[model samples]
Target: MKSNFFRGAVALGALALIPATTAALADGEASSYKALDEFMDVFQKVRSDYVEKVDDEKLIKGAIDGMLASLDPHSSFLDARDFQNLRTQTEGSYGGLGLSVTQEDGAVKVIAPTQDTPAWRAGIKAGDYITHLDGQLIYGGTLDEAVDKMRGAPGTQIKLTIVRPGRDKPIDLTLTREIIQLKPVKWEVKNGIGVINIVSFSANTGADVRQAIRSIDKSLGRKPTGYILDLRSNPGGLLDEAVSVSDTFLERGEIVSQRGRNKGDVERYYAKPGDDARGLPVIVLVDAGSASASEIVAGALQDQHRALVMGERSFGKGSVQTMLPLSNTTALKLTTARYYTPSGRSVQEGGIEPDVRVPQLSDPDYKNRPKFRESDLRRHLINEIKTDNAALEEDSKDDPRFAATAEELKKKGIEDFQLDYALKTIARLAAKPGGAVAQAAPVRKPATH
Candidate 1:
């Protein structure tokens, strides 16, 4: 009798929900149709009464772009060329000028040239503003159009007009495009301590890292007592590579977890039972520019008490993006979900805080530089919890800790003070009783192939 009553109750509840659910669906359909009608009305008006004639394809694509741009800074509708470029980014090679840029204040600004590429080899510095490509004025044009102009077939030459800070006149350069191959992992045995610099994450980053560690260990002839991981200014890439790279350091346990809009969209990635370092005291370096995959590695190691995270706070981008292909050789790079550290903390607006806050005194513009964070982006998600961090504009005055300018530092042979300090600290830790890192190995260029 009890079973019958429970079944009857469930049936009645189902019957009661049907009408309300149907009504809600009808309301949703109506609202959607109304929005579609409004869109068409505006589209017709623009087609018939615009100041200048516009192509149908251009208008439609522009509409799609504007719609996606309204969502978030990361979400965008990619054209055919953009799709190809993204594929090149993940595959780790392409025929282009080898540059990374961002649109800021209606201008395309250089983020950083890919390491060891034509741009980097040609001495293209970050923070430079590009004014023209091939003598074409690009300020009023779209950034993608300018980028498309910059990249081309191998051995093809292109000219760039650049406006750099601290320069009196615009600089022009004629560069030949080449096949850019990114070497994601670089290692050095510095002062008896092993140091790894992860420049970017790509398809083969994990395998490369494993090989690098093996090579360093073999050259060391013994396990190093200390290791330093440098990830400063790394813009980040490939989520799978991030997981695999984190796994390279960790023996076991959760590396990262991701959750989408739905409650059932939670997924976790765990590390295997092996670590390349063999339980060495590791220190990770980060700054405000470190983001995405780099942040993942830093946050995971920090939460697991595996490494001491130093330098400034991260760039605070914890969202995952999936490149979904569309018709016409186009794609949609959508922000699919939010990622969390093992400690159940979201790094959306509030990025991973370091175990030790070590400012980059070597960055001469640290004080006056305008730092852009996720919070500054339009339509960025909010953090679920509060965070404590250094002030965005601490002070423009010169820091007493670092009195030397770039030229002065070059004279002193201090190329990177942050790396120098971390290496020394690790050396000190290793020097303690019964502990010392391996002797320094000869610095050699890492092989990308």
Candidate 2:
């Protein structure tokens, strides 16, 4: 029988959505037994002759960890506790500080903080390096270990020391743990337009979005002529949720597809016959922090000419991880396939490029901010094909509108240039004399992952 497939689940730090599959065993060679003999010999020696007696479970778990570690960063062995934690995150609530992070350059790097959570409210930002936890230096530990250190009972507190770019010295912050209930989709009507902020793709994201749209329509007393789907700094969540979100806007076409190692093991997702958005003018906002399921949505809409994707290139993570349950109550999260857009584009090292690249000029550090992407991941999979680098800067002829600094924009009552730009653009197109929607120029065809 085919193994149970895990669609998507939270990654250790935040939205690490990986696909799951039944593991196929490889044929063993004669030397494989010899290697096992060597491993067993070492295991027995460690159990009997170590400086102090070690727990057999610890030794074995460590062995499994090492084995998975050799495969890739996304492939990991989750103990029973970790297995439970993964399930809790998928359900969209858990007791923790609420941050997504990854291992980078031997330090725990924040991917993005879940909005409204303790960490987000505490000012944790993407690209921040978590160097210490609770006065214990966290360097050199696995991402899972660091995440474990951060998880705690609700109402408890934890201390973290962060090293951020452009900061002269390390900063320390104490955060109280809470049950982070991720609502996933939040919407508000702004100036007769609907603004949807997708926090993550949890199990209920699609349903929540539908409800949000209905609420916005009712509250505004009319259907919105335009919608802005903001996906900035969204790490990602359930893959199925991503599909449903894409389907909400698309009438019919391919949404996404995952190709595994086996020649015949390809999974494709498609949109339903109807579009809930009713073909309204839709704009998608993504950024360097957007990843996985986020990229999937942006790529699908962009390819189908259904939405205009704006902002910087996303956090290029196109690989899918499968959660494999082990015999000993432990589980393995392994990257088993590379996902492609409807047009057969891979978002691995090269992320989804926006149709129009817009710089976040209001932030003073925008130019110098360190970009973290799948390429930055230590063991990220290499694209089976190579693609040109996505646009990383404003086109040489800088737009005067974005040359203003944060202080200047604040003076002009513009707090966020990206959102404001998208809103105005949508409004402009809607107000045109012919009432025609303007689509962004198509992005370059992406090379497969």
Candidate 3:
């Protein structure tokens, strides 16, 4: 029988989401006794003749980890601790520094920080490399070890030594841990516009987004001019949540699709029959940190012409991961398929290119900081059909509108230039004679193969 598919999830750090389904074995594969025999021989040799006595469990787990690591960066064997951590993160509250990180060449690199958390408040950037923790060098250590050292009881302080590129000296900062209650969807009225900031796509994110739209309308006493969906620095989460969020604004259309190994093994998600915002103009704001689920939402809106995507190219992670429970306490996060946007675009190495590329002028380091994306990861899945992203690269020369220095913008009381620009753009569109922001044209429904 075909394996039953369900909800999907993804992450840039230690977790990715999907239905808790067991992995299906190959339909026509013979057991390789020779390989099993070779593995057993090595295990016996390590157990009897190694420098020290190694536990069987440790050796076996190591073997499993090595095998998964060889396939791709997203697949891994999750132990008990990792399984628990995944649950906590998906639930949207955890006590830690609130940073999404990944290991590259034995060094823990920042993926992005959860906004309003200790790491973000302390000005930690996406490309920063963490070299030491609490005055002790942590280089060449396991990612889990670094993560364990970083997370602690709430209100406790930890010192981090960061090695940021383009800086002569390493930067040191002490930050206090806090319960990172990830407010997935937050809304406010910005100059007669509804501004919805989605930090992560955790549990109930879609419902929260629908509520935000309702709340915005209620607070304004009428429909707002437009909406700004701020997905900047979001490190992605549940796949179902992404689809739901996309469905909220869409009237009817295919949102996304995931294709597995077999030719006919494909699943497509579609929006239900209602536009929650009543077809209001939407602008999706993304950056290098926007990934997987974030890409899913952005790509859906952009392809359907439901929203104008603004900001840099996304973090390019289009693969879906299935979490198959190995036992009650552990699981395997295996990359099982590649997802595509409504236009059949797989953002594997080439992320969603924004309709308009807006530079972050309020951050002084915008010019020098190198962007990190899924394509940068070791053993990342290669896109068989390459995408030419030369035109999408951020121009070295600044646009006149973005030439203002961070200090200048700070003086003007504009903390976030991207949001500020999006709000104003919506306002301008609303100012047109009819005062009705343009809605997406009706698209032809896609047929499932």
Candidate 4:
């Protein structure tokens, strides 16, 4: 017999459908009555006969994960705990082993340990594959499961067994959890050039950048001739923060745009007049880890000729995710729309390529070390020639001029190639006519530890 009661229950629980389930509906209309009736019968049959008292939350989350996993690696559902962690990342404080872990090649890989955190101090480097945590094998587990195992209260200890490239055996390291406050922005006047390092885009990122710029001005008593916005290894954050950061550098121009399934979803953000830095020669440093909001800022600056991008391609996360609250403290972070640069470029699968490609110079010892290479990973790079060419056609703009090749950059013999290039570029620009004249000011020396 067809279960009419079950059909009514399924109809009431509209939230059970996946994010893309809406697309299954036509013109904003719900599924047909007959389809819902059949779906409910199957759902009840599965629930009633085979399993133990199944958790509705777990089942829902699993369904959500399955749905998102099929779409893209980057898009996934964030439960309450996951959402809290996401919030903590932006606030720059969290209690954990202090390593950024991401899903790579069907397993969790440590991207990099936070500076001065337990993971870094314990000799956990970027590109280490985590095999086990606290003797619990994580080989086939999800990224969320691995993350849950790693995060805990301060002063708590967790053991991580990892496999490195050159090492034959898995190394076990026990680390204590601590409150990690990420330093998003670091600035210094190196060799009479202003160099700013943007580790990530966060809620406070715009304020942080402004503060750094002001501090530089106070020390030098004049604006920098040129500025370097280093976005290397930046995994990106809030979109509003990225827009605000771009606004600081640009006077009057479109920053970025967004497009969705509906034409009404299209929107553009522009820089306000007062916040422009004018014609300061600027360089944006990027790498494979630089993504989303980072890509937005980099793409906008490069397209507008406001900044010269240095380094390899970015992480190419042009999609915008919005959090939809669910009952029982759970939430869904769905990809709501795809973003484009001011020049109408979609960075989705095709990341923003640098105007200048400067690859990292590997030390002899570091070369053989287990480290994550963007190229070595599969999902990191997607051939988006179609998207790139389409966006180029719409914008009708030429590509920016690349300064030097990766080979030339490797020959510099500099410890930090990106910073070195920025300093050199700034110095050259300063020597030009009508450039910023450095004023003699009492340098406030950094305090000794």
Best by TM-score: 3
Residue-level lDDT of model 3, residues 1-449, one tens digit each, is: 23322222224222322222212222222246667788999999999999988899989999999999999999999999898788778874777899999999888899999888999999999999999999999889889899999988999999999999899899999999999886888888988899999998999999999999999999989999899999998989999999999999898888999999999989999899999988778899999999999999999999888888999999999899999988888999999999999888899999989998888999999888999998989899988679767654844675788889899999999999999988888887677775444445655544642
What TM-score against the true fold does each predicted structure earn?
A: 0.84, 0.86, 0.90, 0.75
In terms of lDDT, model 1 sits at 0.79
**Model 2, CA-based lDDT:** 0.84
lDDT of each model, Cα atoms only?
0.79, 0.84, 0.88, 0.73
| Residue pairs that clash (backbone atoms under 3 angstroms), model 1 | 192-438
lDDT of 1 by residue, 1-449 (tens): 99999999999999999999999999999999999999999899999999998788888998998898888778888887777777777775768887888776578877667766778777676667889888988886788788878878999999999887767789898999998776788898987788888888877888888888887788889787678888876779999999998888887777888989898999999888887887677889987667889889988887777778888777889899988878879889999998988777777777777776666555565554555566656777766676655554354565576565666776777767778778877877766874432211222222320
Kindly list the per-residue Cα lDDT of model 4 for residues 1-449, writing each as its tens digit.
36987887787676667545867665345447766677668667767885587766666567678767676556677777786778788775878877888887567897766656798788786678998889988988778788878888999999889888797889999889998777788898876557787877877888888888888878899876678888876778889999989888876688888877697888889887754344677888987668788899998888767778887678667788887877666777777788887766778766888886654543333435643443355543343444443343244343343244446556765556656756776677668885532221222222420
> Residue 67's C-alpha lDDT in candidate 2?
88
lDDT of each residue in 333-413, candidate 2, tens digit only: 888998999888899888989998888877777876787787877767888777667443534676776678889888988
- Poorest lDDT segment (10 consecutive residues) of candidate 1: 440-449
RMSD of candidate 4 to the true fold? 12.2
Q: Tell me, by lDDT, which candidate is best.
A: 3
